[model samples]
Target: MTNSKKFALVTGSSNGIGRAIAENCAARGFNVLLVALPEPKLEEVTNALAAKYPNQEFHCLGVNLMDAGAPQEVFQWCQKNNFVVDILANNAGLGNSGDFLSKKAEFYFGQMQLNMVAMVMLTHHFLPEMQKLDKAYILNVASMASYYDIPFKGIYAASKKFVSSFSHSLRYELKDSNVFVSILCPAAVLTNPEVIKRDANMGFVSKITRQTAEQVAEYALSRMFNRKPVSIPGVFPKFYRTLGRVIPHRMQLRMLANAFIKQSRE
Candidate 1:
């Protein structure tokens, strides 16, 4: 039997921004389906949310989204369980920073698979069901890096660019439908110890623009629910995105290259 309750299915919900988003969804009275890698952390998060939101349903599946057919597997699992996912949060992604050629080809491929392919495929799988709902939402977590081509993070940035482009185009196509698509482009989210330490080394812009996972989650969900096309959590990131528009492409690329190169050395 199909579950009558609507769910918000969140990818990467074991930790960081994804976890924060999941908590928010539960708070807003939506049942949550948390998806992350198979690990104790995933179990912990699922248990924690279940305890915290006793009235709402909280289920989890541990799966590595980068694997082939993983998106389909997730869809199948939801189907078998009769979970009706009205809100799909594509928040799982891999972000690595280094010279383009420094990483092995396999690493880049896997990054692309997780960051771009998995997101697209998952959306493809869930979009039809979303369209059937009275109202639905797709929140894609991209990065402010999507607006620029950074030197050390070329592949990661490019993949996010793909996300940004794809999301906007999808939103256009779904404009007349019940499904609403929005993208969150946050800058320097301090989600963990490593991210906090990295933000310290990221200079003034990153520091000023940085946000906590909770902050990003709150802002993103608020804006997404309001049907905003793009949600930028911080003021500086919003300003920087606008600034990039007037700057010549060559100059912007050069500036970004220099900044990332310096950060890479630090």
Candidate 2:
């Protein structure tokens, strides 16, 4: 790790909440390491951010995290570039809504690989270095669905639950270290076109709980730096998660079935 300026490494930073977070970090005077798949989107975002923040250094890493070796490769790339990481944001994840049984076995496996395994691997690779620093931050992006088991989005919810649980436990484990870990569980972030349309169709719930990607990104970084264990971005999302805790499991499952199954039919 270089002794020069601090760098914040953000995964899935090509667009959406990840991109916003990266931009926020750069705006706060940290050099940004942008990681995403090898695509034009990555180049476009890196170029735009570099132009926007000409004072802060922006390094682009185009690697697919779905590949098992990608995390190590990213670590090595940073080492080679003499970029010392002061913050790590494990924000790369995917979510799908559908009957689990209807999808191929490989589809579910791939989600596990990307949504869970990749996150763990990235944290594992960067944490030791972060621990060596006087102060460092790790923000793992979970989801509001982590608090409930949704019928149609079973795997997605379960994966996020693992992330939420793992992040909290890891925070305690690293309490004595300089590394501070936090998790962000945002509800409906209007990240893509599909989500934008879905949010409009979901009636009042979406409007109440839903937040824009930029809003979530800004809120998440603030909470993470403050060392908050868990962050639910919007007021309604925080309320919804709090309410989910006391509800009976059977009732929660029933409500999810009624809501999501009805949406599927519609």
Candidate 3:
């Protein structure tokens, strides 16, 4: 018989929100399989978590999910190691900033590959099993951009929109099953890495009013376990989503273009 104890597989957990998610899972008494690219940060996080939570089982699998076969490798690793996950946190993604036409098609396409393709593949890998479980969860991280047609961040927005839509369908398709799915929509979070880097206009993203990375993860997961269809991690982002629905399409696009273009020039 499979172990019924909750196990969580957290992708991109070396740092940022992903790191917080991994730590949070461990704190919640869930055995964690931390997936990230091989690097010093990965090693540091793995070692740190192992030391901090000696009682909880922690396995760090380092692989670049950008590679086509990475998702399958994760599934195989789980099979070989005899680990079954109750939660799959798809947190790995790359941001798409700047002009759309100026970028090579491959750039936009590659962003999709990482953001959408990888997520879909990873979900397919474990979703069937999750559906069968009495209690299971899949947490997908989308962004505030997911709700609108962003100007400068066009491709990134599109990819996240895909995630949001895909997750909604998955939720409905698996409605008969016990597994719950929640897509987290968040606004600009001024994390350590993002904060120090000067945003051309915002000057270190002072406009952002939201929870920290750890707080978002904690809240999102709580709602995920409760089986919320989608969880907007902050008040501002949720308001933005609501605004997107009410605002005129052309006006919204123009506003985004003006704001981001001005920011770029600054």
Candidate 1 weakest ten by summed lDDT = 257-266
Model 1: per-residue Cα lDDT over 165-193, one tens digit each: 99999999999999999999999987766
Q: TM-score of each candidate?
A: 0.96, 0.95, 0.92
Per-residue CA lDDT of candidate 2, range 81-130, in tens? 78888899999887777677777887888788888999899889888778
lDDT to native, each model: 0.90, 0.87, 0.81
Clashing pairs in 2: none
Q: Which rank order by TM-score, best down to worst?
A: 1, 2, 3
Clash count for candidate 1 is 0
Candidate 2 stretches greater than 4 Å from native: 1-4, 263-266
Q: Compared with the true structure, what per-residue lDDT tens digits does model 3 show for residues 1-266?
A: 35544579999899888899999998888889889888788878978888999988888889988788999999888877778888999988877556767678977776787789889999999987777777888999887778888888788889999999999998888888877778988666555443334233544333654568888888888888888888787666666778889999999999888767654443
Candidates 1 and 2 compared: the better one by TM-score is: 1
All candidates in order of lDDT, best leading: 1, 2, 3
Candidate 3 Cα misplacement greater than 4 A, ranges: 1-6, 192-200, 203-208, 263-266
TM-score of 3: 0.92
